[model samples]
Target: MTIRDFESHAPIVDEETFALITELEVRKAVRLQYFVSLLGIEADVEDGQDESEASRTRERLASAIREEIRSCDTIGLVTTEPKLYILLVNANLGNVPLIIERIAQLVSRHRRPGDGLGELTLSMGAACFPSSARDRSDLFAQVGSLITEARRDNAERHRYRLPPAES
Candidate 1:
């Protein structure tokens, strides 16, 4: 089957988006702000190697993220990384949580126990352009830092997903 047949959501080209962002910056389009989010799926090591499992998890997570995003928005895989980047065109910073929540719901639905998927969960961080970043490079840097912070926060809590509330 073709990619289109399997994946209905057409992801934007990361290179092309980078170029477009450069043009947008040159045009001084400060009024237009895009929400850039970096998302990660971490899995536990089942055996001595978890590379294949991690790869599958990332692909599944990317598909879910692509489906969850708006038509106007774009999702792309970061080069040489397991992370996926989503560009929410003309979206506000406040919308970040809603976006992440959507992704979390999808991830949870897709996750299954002992299917070699491991104890997987999604982690995301978003930054708005012109407000959180001045340019594409700045935006990328900030988003990456934010994801790292999110992971660190999760580590501190000693869990990837939120714990169940006590009755």
Candidate 2:
């Protein structure tokens, strides 16, 4: 099983969208921001207390995130220390902020448990393609770098996400 690097295997899309795709492909990569990585949190639900309750919350939020995501979104799984890797196909640096915000808000509101988790401060970061890096090595580095930048400036303008939330 040869692992394909994201830098090498870009998402195949339309021509007009090609420019946009390439731009995004090399710009947004979900990774650790500052020290807050967006990769894992399912297992960290029990930071202080409520294991069963936390588990329930995780399941609900996970469900919400998965359901809200589109079908084209690519998924990469890594069961290393207990984290899930994800890649929203055709996603880019511009839209990650919206996705992150929607997910965060949904998690916060949908997390029925409300027993522990609050505000749902999920610090996330994304790295795109060629613009962000060159090859696979450079690609990985860019992912981390972008994440760090996002973490530092954690804003609501990451770009290319869902439409404005309904009031």
Residue 63 accuracy (lDDT) in model 2: 47
lDDT tens readout by residue for model 2, 58-148? 4445445665666445333333322233455555445666776776667556655644554344444454433343533454444445445
lDDT score of residue 7 within candidate 2: 30
Estimated TM-score for each candidate: 0.69, 0.48
Candidate number achieving the greatest TM-score relative to the actual structure: 1
| C-alpha RMSD for every candidate | 6.9, 11.6
**Which lDDT values do the candidates have, in the order given?**
0.53, 0.42
Model 2, residue 93: C-alpha shift (Å): 1.0
For candidate 2, the TM-score is 0.48
Q: What global local distance difference test value does model 1 have? A: 0.53
Output the worst ten-in-a-row residue range by lDDT, candidate 1.
157-166
